[model samples]
Target: MGLPAMAIVLLMALLQTGTAAAETRAFSKARDAITEPSHAQYEYIVVGGGTAGCAIAATLSEHYKVLLLERGGTPYGNPSIERLEGWADLLRDDPTESSERSPIQAFRSADGVHNRRARVLGGGSAINAGFYNRASDAEVRAAGWKPKSVQEAYEWVEERIASPASLGPWQKALKNGLVQAGVTPDNGLTYEHIQGTKLGHSIFDAQGRRHTAADLLFSANDELLTVLTFASAQRIIFNVSDENKQPRATGVEYTDSRNATHFAYLQDGFQNEVILSAGALGSPQLLLLSGIGSCEHLAEFNITCHVDLSAVGAEMVDNPINAIVLVSPNPLETSLISVAGITHEGVVIEGASGGNWTWQWPGMGQLNIFPPLERSVEMISLVQTNLQNLSSNTKEQIDQSGFILSKVYDPISSGTLRLKSRDVSQNPYVKFNYYTHPRDVETCIRGVKYLHKLLQTPAFQGFRYTTVTPIIALLYPELSSSEGERTDGAYIPDLKNRTETANWCRDTVTTIWHFHGGCVLGKVVDKRYRVFGVRSLRVVDGSTFTKSPGTNPQATVMMLGRYVGVRMLKDRKIAEETVNSRN
Candidate 1:
């Protein structure tokens, strides 16, 4: 071909590529219709486009005009998120990539645990591993949740999301290992069964697509639902005219990515409700910024206290988790599994009754273990026995596939969120206080030890496995070698004399990212999810969870959003009827 002709062809190809990219970009930008001033006002305002906000906006838009405000920009729609097999790739990104974009400013614990969350649209769901597990009936009851209410909601969510439960061959191998360790299959703790095992089914749709709230809700109304991306809510505007001091939220003031200020008004001056669906950290921070939290804290900022509710930022709870990575003799391809209730004799241990200690594993099949706490000890013994039983080839398979055992201990250490500065632009001061409770630390240690025993079994004899324990060495180097001796001495210190070394590891600790409980039900929000002493203001998100479920919270958050959306619609209808009757 002639040089001129070749140059022309290349130019045409470049234009085609740019056009295709623009079309894809336009598709994503189209969802941000709410940011437009003309589209600002709505019957309802749902803040934070994470798990619950997406569902709430989708449900409310079906019946009423809705405006959804998300602080982060549109997702990149990376191939990793789209492919079902590459789900782990989402978790493989650098911690900074996740942290810098997160709505909450995360910090490392004194002992080296990093608390991180997603700030982007679809919230954590966009970045999470998509492990969906329902709350156990006993746990719900303990939290003053009605069994019938939760069951109905769980069933609705399951059917809507088409909860993934089938264990493929890879998942089965992991399940086999867990069973050999004495974890029996329990369906009740699974997402579908509610009292099943801790093992959850992978969240995949009928077309084998990963099922996420973003996919479910965004697909519902591409044209109608206006999602405002990169718009951060600074504060909520309340109607000062209400004689009863019942706050009628007028609108919200927010800042877009371009640093432009914008205001979204409510419809008809109708005083529609404002739903704070921002996750635990974001919700409380927004409330405190709006002068609705503890009067003392707000007073310090010289902001007039709107509601002097002390519980607004108290009672923060998160399930502390520790992971164990083992090299299997067999090439165990990675497949997600939920081992709901691990039992030895008859009693289930993880979620036991008495405050947060209650035992409940929803969704997995119910197989009662003998003597609750003893089950943990027995599980350790059984895992050791099973490792001995596995063939050398099986160990090799697991090593190649990157077999990892994840253990989530019910955290007894309760933390609180306090406002460090009233500045909306600055992140709040959050104290996770993780591992503060000796029991929580012990449970985590036991879980790690349990995993180590499994790796030492004869089944894994020929496999080369390593235990990465930076935090243990940093905090208690003395316990390092002794613990290493028991596990074949795989401890190796990768960092040396760096101030941020512990912080980096803490930031990297594999977290479920299931932050919940600040502004929790009964403590901060009422049973109906309405903020105490405030009207026309409700919170709908994982933050409102009275207690964080033992497993993933995406399913629960979505269900709550739907539940609150339905309630809001019903309330509007009742008001309309009352006005008509009076007329």
Candidate 2:
């Protein structure tokens, strides 16, 4: 025998861990969970090695020494994170697992709604649905970004993390349903943001593995890039200033794997800076913790105010989705589908087919999308052969295979994030305040109606056995005025689309996880993404987004990171030596 089975398994685990923990692991330790002593300093200290954090650090590392601090482990050896079918694994909350080490952090909003976010190196990209798309012209221009620069950034990101997705059987059916429902001119397969239905790209590779924002690091000058996993950034460290000089941020205080504390400082010259890309919730949390948020709230926590910026953790937006799970008679292939419906008002009816439905949602049948069929005495009597061998679990799994996750893109409802306490490891309070706006309620209704129309089409009916998701039908009773049936030439009236059922919208509305706008572009920071009243400090994540980007934020968030990185490279204040890091 080539080694014992248990021995082989142990050896393989060690090798996998070794590969992921090579250099970065050395920066952290485990005894009492403390970071070991080190004299190493970087030109830039990027906090929260997440989606934008990775992109910014990687881009800047092309010429400068960069230290990327992440609180979670590397994504390398995680089977649940690497495999396409493991999407839900990244979003699942295991309360039994400690927040400090868990890949998914569970959170509840002030409104009392709960959600989960990625705590791993790749951030949301490591846990999201992996649907990729470029930001619209309106969205890019909102930040006063040059189209060419933004375009270049988008291309750079695509080259590293994006691949054309091949439509599986379910995806093909979704495409047919969308087109048959008059989604638009049919843009076909693309990553561009066009006002028509199309099959976009995914972060998943043709090999069926996930390619997250962390993968962008490979494109960086590795010699200058240092990724420290399990390195939780506690707060931004700043240098004080005299009367004539503005205060500048010089470094960051972080805790490593061993819970050992460490400080990473910016170099003395060349305008060395500290960037905070710690995600929508994370970045704002860091800012507030560093005494950069509302002064009144800071006082309540017995923390001294620094910036007193009221908008640091305010003005958030997310796309409220209306998920409809349709049950099909035939079993479908397990893959990410890319069919979508686009409108000029920035409303998108996009969804994914439920592939890998069983593993992704083990108890999803409990949703009662379809009531299980009770066995009849006649059917039991008719079954004359193979009754003992039939797997009832497999049959139940097959019955729940069909799914359609419909979404209403770019909602108008804005939310906020606040700190629960001064403790660094503690999660901040979140309030999505979803569907408070009249427009958002209408959009949700319209999305539900549009999905209903899609279901009515003959192409979808050819395979779809019945409608299992009844929320849409409940929100607007007119879709069911005719028993939710697709009648020939029966167009749902415009009045139905504008239903004013506010409470239903609130109860049914939820985020697709594309949160933006906390430390806004101009209000919170300059277009260059610096925090006001702070020097050498910047927030370069979705937290800087001022409004809806009119699409999935993953790609746009990366592009913004790249765009801001280029500007930092060209900063006039940073001395030439400090800025140029070709060495």
Candidate 3:
């Protein structure tokens, strides 16, 4: 006799549960989290298991034992972070989620623009739109890095994380539109940051699965590397010399999830070092907290000053972005940044289309992805009156909309980072005075004009839903003198009038999330990336960059970690050989 229907159903459910248990998920706790207290010694202690942190640790682990301390947990098995489709959702802040465990930490800048930083193992690379492009040869030489070594470093990172992106419908259209707008010499598909329209490399695979800097850890000698996630580095442990009175970083003091403190130390060798790869904001913040920043500032917070480096949190900069949102007539593919139009005047154009547009402010005319804070009243009011017209649109129409954005290649205007609170978990206050420099305003104007040219291209006409009101045209209408539509069907007022263009640039300025500086090359660190007044301490991250490399800095940042680690190994080998021969 056959089994009863209910019995068959129960058996099927049991079988399914068994199969689920047997299957392994990718990147699910690939690196185990450390919850217990650890007091250990290693040849190298790298703070911040971020992009550079992971790379350097892996490279160093080949010969020396390394400890990589990350304040946040692993990105493994996080659906929101591991999938490209979850880009915006990954950035959106949830009030219910605690900052102590959130993969992305959202913070409001003093400039009134809201931004976010990574709090995961892979750092920004885990949360960012996975566009990968190499730095120009000029940038490599300017940084005083050897060309061959830089190439090798980049290749090492690329082989593990980056691959050629297969352009989706939206990116394909963007490529055609860019070329039609005279961004000529289409480089087809490439990883190099050349001047032209090209499809850059992506850390996302063909299946849209993201690969972050944490994956670089696979290169590490598993036995020699110890990655401690949920381990917040409180401060650097330094030992001052009695003879010279100079401080040398000896180890790092951190707290586990349970708030129990632990100390991780370096080995006895003089050459063994403590490196800070703790990002642009993080490295400086750690220095200040560790009593290595400005003496006056430290005293204000009741902290003793050790190094008195005034430039520790100076020269903060962010590339200002201005975007135009368009309602598309046809359904568009959801994609992260995959195409770039590089111009001669130091402006870059990139775009993305189709995602959950449910995150929006009423009458704000801006996606919540680039939401302005309450203090941004001027910016809010600038477009508030104009966006009221779209209040009646259905939610579905807004979902079909896409954006084309532009940014200045290298902005000159900058600000400083200061401590908001002494707490290690608190975000340091930073302001990037966007468009403050006259040249930056002009560069933005040039970039915006190119965006206009791109919209007028025939290739984009099919995708545009002109009848549904353009948010950009409504927000920043051309001045009366040039208010009329041209033959290309775009309002030329904002594009033709310098004053109007400048206003648009200022009013709508948002971050491309490419902020750099705070701990600059010559000011805070020497050519070797060592903190000037300290011994056996080095900072090797975006914090040391004079200017951001290429269209994005992720590739270069990862390469830098490997590059420096290899150099350190070579130098140590030479020193050891010399000592042996003399003996």
Taking all chains together, each candidate's TM-score versus the true structure is: 0.73, 0.82, 0.88
For model 1, residues 48-103, the per-residue Cα lDDT tens digits are 88788887888788767777888775544544444444444443332234343443
- Stretches of candidate 2 exceeding 4 Å from the true structure: 1-39, 95-97, 241-244, 355-391, 394-400, 466-503, 572-583
Q: After superposition, how far is residue 207 of candidate 3 from its true place, in Å?
A: 0.6
Q: Candidate 1: worst 10 consecutive residues by lDDT?
A: 356-365
lDDT of 1: 0.54
lDDT computed for candidate 2: 0.66
Candidate 1 lDDT for residue 407: 39
Give candidate 3's total backbone clashes: 1
Name the regions of candidate 3 deviating beyond 4 angstroms. 1-34, 95-98, 241-245, 357-393, 466-493
lDDT of 3: 0.77
Clashes of 1: 69
Candidate 2: clashing residue pairs, number: 9
